[model samples]
Target: MAGGRLSWAGLLKWSLSYVDGAGPSGAVSEEERRWLAEAVERHMMVDVVSRMREIALLMSTPPAVLEAQGITHDDIEDLLSELQVHVESIDMANDLHSVGGLVPVIKYLRNSNARIRAKAADVVTTVVQNNPTSQQLVMEASGFEPLLSNFRSDPDLTARIKALGALSSLIRNNKPGVSAFRLANGYTGLRDALNSESARFQRKALSLTHYLLSESHSDCSVFAQLGFPHLMMRLASSDDSGVREAALGGLLELARDTTLGNRSLLAEHDRLRRLLRGRMESIRTMTPEDLDAAREERQLVDSLWITCYHEPSMLRNEGLLVLPGEESFEQPPDVAGRFFEPMRRAAARRAPPVEGSDPGDGTGGGIVLLLGLAPDGRSNSPSH
Candidate 1:
C-alpha cells in the first residue's frame, strides 16, 4: 500500500482504519479484518518460508558447494534468530507448523555446527514456551527425540541448556508430551542435567522436575527411585538463588506428597533439617534489595522445614513468610539436630548407597552444579 514493503501490522492498521481507500474499501468490517490479518501473515510468512528453505538447501548441500557459495552455519544461525522472533507470535508459531518448518528445525538439533544446533533448540524453545498448540505440533512432529538427545548428551553445554529449555516447554501442561518423555526415559536425562557443571542447566532441570513432581505424586516415586531426593537436597544448597529456589520448590512438592510413603522420606531427617535451618538463618538478614527468588526461597524453605519437622519454624512463628522487613522463627534447630543422629543411623543402616556414588561417602558433598558453577567451582559454563 506504501512505497516500502508491507508488514502485517501496517496492513491491518490500514485495512481496519476508521476511514480508508487503500483497497477500494472504507473501514472493513471485523469479519473482513480477520481475513486481512490471515492474508498478511501468509503473505509476510514468505520471509520465514524462504529462510527456512535456505537453511534446508544450505544444510543439505555438499560442504564444497556451500563453501563455493560462501554459505556457513553462521548464516543458518542468523536465520534461526530471525525465525525465533517471528515464532514468538502465536500465529507465526502455528504458521511455522503449517508450512512444515518444524522438521528442518528438529533436524538441525543434530547438525554438525554446535551454534546452529543450540540456535535451533532456542528457536524451538521460543516456539513452545507458552503455546500449547505449538507444543502439540512439535510432539506430533517427533521433535522430542532430538531435543532430548541434545539435552542429554550434546557436547556443547549451551546446546544442552537450550535443549533442556525446549524440552521443558514441550512437556509443560501437555500430558501426552509428558508421557512421551516418560517413554523416552526422560528422568535419567534430568538426573544427568541435574549433575551438570552449569547453574543455568541446573535451574532448568530443577524447574522442570518441580513441575513434574507437583503435577502428580506418582512421579515422586519415580523421581525418588532415581535417587533424585539426594540431588534435590544437594541442590537446595546451591549458591545460585534461582537454582536454590527451584530446588526448594521441588523439595516442597516432594515433602507435600504424603502418599510416597511420606513419613519416612524426609520427615525429621537431620541433614535436611540442618540445610533448611541454614537457609532459615539467612532469611533474617535479607534486605528489600534482595531478589524475589530469595524471598520465595525463604517461603519454600520455611514451608519445607515445617513439613519435614511437623512443627512451626522460627520464621513461621514470626510471620516472616512474606519476606524481608517482616518479623519472622520458633523451632530451635539445635533440638532438631538431635533427631539427625538417630535418623542418620537408621538411614545409614537401611538406605542403599546412591547409584554411582562411593559407598563410604556419607557426606553428600557432590552438590548439584548450577549454571556457571562447577562441582569444584571452576566452570566455564555459559550463563543464561
Candidate 2:
C-alpha cells in the first residue's frame, strides 16, 4: 500500500486494474484484493462522516445567525423542512427545543409565506405532540395564538388543516393550555374546522372538541350553544368511518355532561334519537371484527340511549351503574316517565277490562298499574 492520499476514483482504478489482469498477467493476490477493498470501504465511511458533520453544524446554527446571514424566509422554510424529517428522533426534538430552534419555528407560523406557515405548523405539531414541556414552551412563545388565527382565517386549506392539527396537539391533556385556548375563542376556530370542506380537518377538529368538552362543563356549555352537538350528530353519520368515530366520541363526552340542561338539550333532539336508533341497528348486525372497530361508537350510542330514555336499567346493563352516593344532587329521576304515566293511566281506563277479570283487581286487562309505591310495600294509588 502506498503512503499517499486515497481518492475514490484512484481506488476504483486500482480495483479495475486488479480485475483486468494488469497485475501478474491475470489477477491480484487475495491479500492485495482484500487491502484494496478495505481501503475503499474506509474512504467511503470517511466521506459519509464528513458530510454528516456538515449537516450537524448546519442544523445546530442558531436562528439569529441564519437571520444575520440574510437568509430569506424560503431559506428558513427549507431548514425547518429538513428539521421536520428528523423530528421523530427524540434527541433531535429535545436538541431543537434546548437550542431555541422552536422559537423561530413558532414565529414562522405567522410568516407571510403560506408554505412557510404550513411547514412551521407541522413542525410545531410534531414537536409538541405528547411532549408537555415543548407544549408549554410553545405556549410561552405565543405559538398558540398564531395557530388559532391560522385555523380561523388561513386561506390555504392545507395551512388551516396543519394549524388545526397543531392546535389539537398543543392542548391535548394540558389543562392550562386548554384554558388558554378556550379563552382565545379557540372553540370558534374548531367549529370552523368542523365545517371545513376537508374531512381531515373536520375529523381532527371533532377529536379536539371532544377533549375540550370532556375537560369542563363550561366548555361543553359553550360548545353546545355553538351547535356542537348537532354538528357531531351529523358527523356521526359521515361516510368516512374515522370522521364518524371522532364525531361519536364527541357526542359521548357531551352525553356525559352532568349538567341537566346539556343532557336534556341533547336527549330532546329528534335527530339524535334517530341517529342513535340507526347506529344501534347497524351495530347489532356488525361482524365481530367490525364490532371491535366500532366499540366506541356502540358505547356512545348506548350512552345516548340511556340519556334519552332515562333508563337506569340500560346503564346497569352497560356496567355504568351509578351508585347512590355517586349520583349528582341536581339530577332528578326519570321525571319524563312520571309526567307521562297519568296519560297512560287515562288511556288504560278508557279500554275495557279483561272479560274474565274484575276492574277492581288493580289491573286493566293484562296491564299492571304503574302507580307510585310507598316505602312500606304498598301502592300510593287508592286501594281497590
Candidate 3:
C-alpha cells in the first residue's frame, strides 16, 4: 500500500493476497478509495471492479488524505462524492468523443445515494448526447430497465429528475443502433415521470416523450396504450413555467407526428385550432394587456413557424403575414426591423414562377413575388 503507482497487475496481486487474509484487515489505514477506484477501474476485471465497487459503497467517509494503511468511512464517502462528479465529467467527455467504454459509468447511475444516482444519469445522458455507439452499449447493458424501475419508487426528486433527463437524452436518437429497440420499453419510464409529483420531472418526461414520438419511429400505440394523451393533458396545467412550456411543446411536437396527428393527439384539434384562431381573432379585439400578450405569443408562433418551415420563401411569406401593422399600434419596430432584412433577402432570391416548369427544377424564382403577394392577393403597393 505504498504511494507507488497502482497497476492492474499489482492490484490483482494485492487483491488476491488481501482476499486470502480475509479482506485487507488491520485497516490499511492510508489506502484512499479514489486511488483504489482508479486502480480497480483500470483493472477492468469483473472481480476487481466488483470488489472496488463494494469497497466504495462501504467507505462513505468524507475526504482525508489516505496513507499506505487505509481510508476511513468519512474519507471514502467524500472521495465517492467527488468520484461521481469526476466520472460524470469524464463520461460526458467520452460521450462527446464517441468512446465505447461507458458501461461502468452507467452501472453507477442508480447508486443508492441520490446525488450519485443523479450524476450517473448525467453521465449516461452525456454519452447519448453525441456518441451513439456508447449509447448502444449502455442500452444493451440493461441500463434503462433498472433506471425505469427506479422511477417507479425512488423518492429522491433529484434522482428521479436525472433519470427522466437521461431517458430523454437516450430517446432523442431513434435510428438503427443498439438503442433502436430500447425505446420499445421507454414508454414505461416516460409514463412514470409524467405522473411524478415534481414539475421538473413532468417537464423532462414530456420533453422525452416528445422526442420519442418524433424521433423514434416506434408505433404511437405504446403511448396511446399507456394513456399518455390524458397524462399530457393533465400536465398542461402545471404551475411551473418550464413545466407548462414543456407540456405545450411536447404536445405540439406530438401533433406534428403524422402517426399521432391523425389519432387522438389532435382530437382536441378544435380546441387547439380555436386557441390559435382566437389569438388572431382577439388581436383585433384585444385590450392593451391582451395586445402585449398577443405580441409575445405572435413572436413565439413566428419562431415556431420559421423553425418548421425553414425555406426562405416560406419564411418571407409567413413573416409578412405575421408582422404587426401600423393599425396595431403596439407593434415593436425593432422586432420588425430585424425581421425585414431577412424577408427582403428571401424575396430577392425568389424567382417569378415560369408558366409551366416543375417547381422542383431548382427554379424557386417565384420567391420574391410570393413574398410580395399579400395574404389577400391584393398588392402590397400603395393605391394610386
Residue-pair clashes per candidate: 9, 0, 22
- Model 1 earns a TM-score of 0.71
Please give, for residues 1-384, the per-residue lDDT of candidate 1 as tens digits: 222234555766776664355456565576777777788767666655665555555555666787788877777788788778777878778777666677778888888989989999999998888898989889888899899889888999999999999999999999998998988899999999899878999999988998898887888989988988789889888889888888888878888888867545787567788888788778766665663447677778778887787788887777667655653433535875685577666665675556787755544423222345667878756456
Per-model TM against the reference = 0.71, 0.61, 0.50
**Superposition error at 339 for model 3 (Å):** 21
lDDT score for residue 200 of model 1: 93
lDDT value, residue 345 of candidate 1: 63
* Residues 77-195 of candidate 2: C-alpha lDDT, one tens digit per residue: 67677667656555555556555576667777877789989998988888888888778888887888889899889998889999989888888989878888878888888888787
> Each candidate's lDDT (Cα)?
0.79, 0.74, 0.55
Of 1 and 3, the candidate ranking higher by TM-score: 1
Distance from true position, residue 42, model 2, in Å? 20
- Put down candidate 3 lDDT per residue, 10-48, tens digits, no spaces: 765676566457575644333553466566666553343
State the lDDT at 185 in candidate 2.
83
